[model samples]
Target chain A: MGRTADYTNERCSVAATLEVVGDPWTLLILRDAFAGVKRFEQWQDRLGVARNVLAARLKTLVSHGVMETRRYSERPPRHEYWLTEKGLALSPVLLTMAEWGDRHVYGRDKSPVLFRHKTCGCAFHPVLACEACGQVVDRRDIERAGPQDLTAPTVGEALDAVKIAAE
Target chain B: MGRTADYTNERCSVAATLEVVGDPWTLLILRDAFAGVKRFEQWQDRLGVARNVLAARLKTLVSHGVMETRRYSERPPRHEYWLTEKGLALSPVLLTMAEWGDRHVYGRDKSPVLFRHKTCGCAFHPVLACEACGQVVDRRDIERAGPQDLTAPTVGEALDAVKIAAE
Candidate 1:
């Protein structure tokens, strides 16, 4: 191993996010979620993941508001987990990372969970662009346009959502 | 106790990248590279990392052509490492991850690195936008203007880069 990896003691935002979603299972969970895997048993079956690990990841995501648990069956006290807005917002991040992987790591002919634009009816890259100008943009070009109101106690980050709407 | 995360063996690209760069030392090394930390000793001092691990990560990145090693000081037979175009291309990925960490893990006021747009002089979100419309784009709206000469093994993807680009 090149470097000894440690995240438990770090107080960085990426680490914080990673603390919840950095593992193979969590992302795969989200991947399945995006691919329409909602039920816990379905996730367990599709991913071939341990039940304990799946339960824990779902619990953590729910605790963090990345996912929500809704009662689907009253008799069995069964609940269905769904992506919250916060969870759904991660689509772009996942797509971008997937694209990056597809380009550099995966086989050239690997099949990806294809995404099609609902509005324009086109298949596109997971890119960042200016809505007003239609040109590609980076982190340096956008500004925080919404209020910051975090519910949790992050090391340094606020819990409020920053609107991505470009000015 | 939290969840168990081992990204190195995962099949996803983020996991694959993390297997290479997600570790603290590798990230710090890349951080130093972007920060102009080229010398081996400099990385050693700045990151408080083991010399062997540092050497290994560097070698690995160089092998992948993410960074290139060049002889700079002939007097001592010394060499320095610089990022390749592929490495430079990772700027957005790094920034996006860092931004996520800063926003979710660390608080806004405590962000380690601050990015400002040179042209507009404003803080921006490392967002993904559409190349055609120049608007903040999603995955669905983009078609792959894929690689021109893909010689790597093909998996099962149906469309080629040319076809994706033509769309």
Candidate 2:
């Protein structure tokens, strides 16, 4: 709380993303959304969240363009919350979180739910892979580059990189 | 917070995981950990988090076994926080979250930081692949199985599945 509360402008992507979905309840809402729960009452009942909290989270999501609303019925003005393409792209974030939980928290075969690949029909886990080389990313395999790189820089090099990237 | 603040026992893995690292500040600390900031003062300086909050989070992480303490200085018995194997396993959760922010918030090629796969030396993005079949996983390719399946379950099937899995 000491720093400025506005984190969306941070250069750190995780910080930026967490600004949007770091709240445990917000992430739960997104989990339900992926499960095809769209109606307000459904999320309320499923998450057992306070009405005000759910409404506020939904509003934030819509404002951020992660979700869009469509009227399911005009007669009573019922609306359904749906994931926008940007929200759908968060599939990996959520899935990998779940994957970590399954492995480290639930202990593999003890997972309460299973993700079965529909095409392959095998209960699966999310593997992080390098898009450039098609290699499964091991923790030992990654290094940071650019402004945050742990090593190396010329004068103004870091600032210039950020400015260029911003542009 | 109504249901239970003790989320570590939740049946959901993401929920359990969130119980440990869901706090924005906690996640930020872990981010710094991955960036190789180990000592107490380093995290404090980098994050600007209040001493009490930072101390509480480090204690929580150590208690949960996600991190461990190693004595790095004998003068005052100073210790450095380090990620345990279980904690290192969370690399994907943080990295994927950053990847999402890079794509959705910053736009492609605008990331302030880039992850270079040291093995290949290419700035890379994370791709979710199904560990079972070795194919890249698509949203369209995954469906829930067991208790959380969207449809088709016998009376006791779901409950029984959870029990068996929890075993």
Candidate 3:
């Protein structure tokens, strides 16, 4: 299942995003790419993923505009994969996942890698906040706007039409 | 593949996290669960996923302690899935993905659903920030500690050993 597995008609943004980077191998590849592992053989050696699957994933990511290939050497015509602007934007997603694993999977004392904020020189964890008020938001702090029914008529219009029909 | 597909030998936190909820369908099912779609039938209806796949995903989530099943109806013995504390902690990961999609996949002008911070009554976008300094941390503003090699000896001992070997 490549790009065709996308939930194209789904009205959810998360679903849309998952369609692009939802698979484990893809996510691992992206993680490795962020860690400066660019060569195809390096990724294969690092991830232990099958060559065909890696090739397909690289192709899918490139097609999705998440990554781009560049030729570094002309002798053997070697190409390396690099994250595009869109792909770099996924850093937070991966960071949050690692943080979650650090907290839940491995105890806090045994984190594999620590993320330090260069500005503050303090090791820190990522948090979701209200961009407007800068308040840390949790599931309870957030509310969904409305039902995401793309097939249904707008609620207000539907209600008005029903009222008119009754009248 | 189910839980057996996990990269258990990999010491990376991100890889550990991926082992839990890496598949596209599992992520979609978790998305639906976060949206308060608890009933099995509701997940089936919302995701349009095959029954067997949905069952496997739900079972994996339960085994991983991300979700739990509750007896919702005693008459028909119906059960509903609910996110555990560990699962709810994944909100940031999901929210980040949605925000990325809102920016890159779907234009900002046409978001499917909006997330509002109930505490401040303001719409919010999730951002990755340093928990200590409360500053937004970009990829350049952060540094990875070191290679997450499980096989590596302790850093201090390994360095001493390397020096001894060199001597």
Candidate 4:
């Protein structure tokens, strides 16, 4: 059974972002958007998603301002979904996810879809780089400048006393 | 009512990855993994997730090979979770998601957690770049180097045939 997941009570941004676009369907629709996909029919055909589900997802995206509907055909009342600046910002999230899937899930060069750099004509992946040095960063090179206490053990002192029963 | 979502039948890497770590709790766990939190107790304490729920999430991660458990205390039989090579590769995904959440959800400099580059003594954000040129790439600058056809309009020509019904 699908679970009813919500992070609204959490103050974390990831939780908040997930609240809006965390669903696989929503992410998939956004993936299509990066491909310049527009129109209700286009998303339905590409994703093979049910019509109502697709419509609901699109509506959610629009309400969140990740996407907007523009009238493409006046007489026909046809509209197309377009990514807003906020939506466009999701490219990295999608790209990095695809890359992870490509590397770990599909193996190198096996995934069907690829993002190519226009300037270099080379296939590129997302890199986490330092803004000051432009050097690629690894976990070992970074530290948490936390505004919250991630170190405090919240389970209680009684649990901490259980080191004698350890495992 | 909650709905079950699955992309198992899809060939997409993103979909495949989602099948493994798509749940909000699962991602939050991974985010904690990147932060160097290893013990079950640490995750439980930090996330405030239900014990059974956190246990289940940790089990899923371990079974998927994203994480591994190591015996840490011999007398107590204590164990700790650590990221595997495959799991470490997920840092970019977590980082990027956090960046997106910070920028769009919480606004700049407001996220309680910030990743600071130790080398540069500066806060850094994830950027997608070309491997060859190393310059930042945008959607308009790059085109899909597809091994698949994303340009195909799927909803049937009869609907698109309504161009005469212009909006």
Candidate 5:
């Protein structure tokens, strides 16, 4: 427990994202949103989560722009939750996690759900590719450029220029 | 709080994966491994984390086959941690989270350690495609069919023929 509870100490993007949505509940809530569940009660029902916790997670996600709130009905001002562009960007993360789970945890059972690439017409395997190249990356290909670059080019240029993979 | 903490409670693959590596430090440790930081002290130095927490995370990852432990040197019996093939599969998840953080937390100033497609020489965006037509996917185009497949199959099987996407 001596480790600082403050997750901000780590200066990595992965850590930062975890600080916000790494919790079990947060990811689950996001899953429900993708499943088309929006109303507060609906999220609570599908997830079987505590009302208070669901409320808090929803507030945090909305504030963080991982999700957005809109009125589904006008009379009483009822709202529905939807993934914003930012939230939709999380599709890869969620899909990857689910695929991993399917392999290790659900080894014997069929993947109750599968992610199909609408274009490829096959089961989608989420991969990291070099935007510059189109190769499937393996280890030993990436290099360590710090979050800040240390070249004559301003740190911004260096940072922007970092293509860890061929891309 | 009301949501079941265990993934086995649900049949979802994402839920299953969370049951194992969903803890906070697990992925961080894996991230360090991918970055080529393997020794316990190096991990501590880079992560600025408590010794016990790092040890525990390493242990969990190894036990789950997400990581492997090997003696770095003979004299001291000192060991280094490394990712297994299973562990390497996490690249997509890590990339997704990193991209999410770069967008939300870093905004324009922060950017992903660009991933290039070694073969293509362009920035690669992992697009979910249709297995049937090899077309890119949008929400309106697909329907869910769970492994159980108790529900009727709609004609527009544009998406993967998995379980119905539960609502």
Candidate 6:
């Protein structure tokens, strides 16, 4: 299949994020990283992904700072991939995707993997909640603002805006 | 680029879900659907995606029951695509992705489009929480279990297991 054009110039945040981890291969690779699979050969074996493709995806992740490489052995110069904070934050996305699949696709009563809340020591389903009011957020609660002026600010400006908004 | 092999036979719920919505283009189309872009033309205009690819994606979503086409005009025989319940369930996935982009990719002070918790009437950020105990779930709280038997059960068996587990 032909690769789609990059969304580098797109102002949508989703598009921007997709630029980094939107591809299925990339997401699957991240899934393995979260599962504690590190070595290159391990990813290839577990995912059954093409060697070149896996190599490419890993390289992209490292370049984007989602994953970091560490040398584990000196004899053969072995390296392993690990998730960074930014990458770890993607857990919600993965969990939610799995939950959806379990409910709609798998028709399963329980998920293949269950998530436990360490603080409470109970199995839990992840949900979206409002940070300000701590209320669950639904589709009806969201709307696109500045729809006509969809051009998003540059990354620096966005960071500044977030800071100001926080204040 | 060659397409990755399908995970249709995979027993993992995540892989199953990826089989449906894992591709970047497919996910992007879903994102547009959530954003209220329904018509084929509108999607083309907004996404700049190839016509054949867009058509294929729309067809796939419709076939999977994520989207349904309704005739809006009989004279011109035009149809508009709308999200089904299963499709609407994907809101969290899209929101999480956009939120990720806002925080990491854009470095924005806030998301370009803000999500409001309509029930609470407050701007919100989505968070993962445990359903069993209602505690917030952190990265450290999660671990993969039954790694030796990664294969998940069929729908019927899974449902039965869930019921038993509940007891």
lDDT string, candidate 3, B2-52, tens digits: 432447667766776777787767878888888788888898887788888
TM-scores vs. true structure, each candidate: 0.67, 0.84, 0.85, 0.81, 0.76, 0.85
Error of 6 at B112 (Å): 2.8
True contacts kept of each: 0.29, 0.73, 0.73, 0.61, 0.42, 0.63
Q: Which stretches of candidate 6 lie above 4 Å from their native place?
A: A119-121, A145-167, B119-122, B148-167
Q: Which tens-of-lDDT digit does each residue in B1-167 have in candidate 2?
A: 11323343346767767766776688888998998989999988877778988898899888667899999889978899999997888888998888887777766646678888999898879998888777877888998776653342322343344346546
lDDT of 6 by residue, B1-167 (tens): 11665565456667766777777688878887887789999999987889998898898788667899999999989999999998998887888888888778666445567655667666556787666655556767865543534566643454344346546
Interface CA RMSD of each prediction in angstroms: 7.8, 5.6, 6.6, 8.3, 7.1, 4.0
Off by over 4 Å in 5: A1-5, A73-77, A129-167, B1-4, B120-143, B147-167
**Mind giving the per-residue lDDT tens digits that candidate 3 earns over A63-101?**
777999999999989899999998999998999998987
| Residue B95 shift from truth in candidate 4, angstroms | 0.9
For all candidates, the clash counts are 38, 0, 0, 11, 47, 4
Summarize candidate 4's per-residue lDDT along A17-36 as a digit string, tens digits. Answer: 67678876888889888867
Best by lDDT: 3
Look at candidate 1 and tell me the lDDT of residue B39: 88
Top model number, DockQ:
2
DockQ for every prediction shown: 0.25, 0.46, 0.40, 0.30, 0.28, 0.46
**DockQ, Cα level, model 2:** 0.46
Local lDDT at B126 for model 3:
79
Q: Which sections of candidate 3 miss by over 4 Å? A: A1-6, A149-167, B1-5, B149-167
Give the C-alpha miss distance for residue A95 in model 4, angstroms: 0.5
**What ranking of all candidate models by DockQ puts the best one first?**
2, 6, 3, 4, 5, 1
Classified by CAPRI criteria, candidate 2 counts as: acceptable
lDDT of 5: 0.63
